[model samples]
Target: MLYAILAYHVEEEVASWTPEEDATVMRDLNKVHGRLNELGRLGPAARLGATEGACVLRGPRKGVVTDGPFTESKEQLLGFYILDCADRDAAISAARDLRQVNPSAMYEIRPVKLYLPGVPFPRTEDGVDA
Candidate 1:
């Protein structure tokens, strides 16, 4: 199974971290990443650019574009990790390890659905599971 571990943190608080603090956090994350790599569980991972560079395109009827994520929340999404694990428990364990090093960071683990060409998606306009 594949799980997406989404990392979240306060933008202002993260930006205010000192050089030493930033280095320490990165060091700890690197250790976790290395362990995942050895286990062949780490897939795609990346730290997103600031929300200032983000934009949201509305549905076709409106077709309007808006700057920023425009979320009604304080914590902003920081990064994400895709882990190939045996099950949800394994994925949760991996996320827990990361949370220990960065207590302020919140991780959301979600199962990933793969989309294949020529295969119909599960949900349809009629609300039936295909």
Candidate 2:
């Protein structure tokens, strides 16, 4: 099965949710998650905290260090799901369903590349890496 990542861009200040509302959303999402699980398509899914909670380390010496996201965009990543699907269309269909649960958010569906030892990377129709 092919894998796809479903990422969401959440408004910085709008990512927070009241405890009550959070519980409600979780209940709804769990229903969908259960359906995916039954289909043997769910891989992983989780909600991330604020960008400020992230730490970046770079270089061999790890001299380059940063807090939160590097961009100045108004939206930051809130969470994501990695799903096993048959194709991009299936991934998009899943994402569209997710959007209905979080209409105010934006989602990006990206295919996950898999590299196995001793096997050449898959190539696209145009000769680009798949």
Winning candidate number (lDDT): 1
Candidate 1 residue lDDT tens string, 41-103 = 988776766778789998788798989787778988989999999999999999999998998
User: Number of clashes in every candidate structure?
Assistant: 0, 0
Worst 10 residues of 1 by lDDT: 120-129
| Per-model lDDT | 0.85, 0.69
Error of 2 at 5 (Å): 3.0
In angstroms, give how far residue 34 of model 1 lies from its true place: 0.3
| lDDT per residue as tens, model 2, 94-114 | 887777776767787887777
State how far residue 113 of model 1 sits from its true place (Å).
0.3
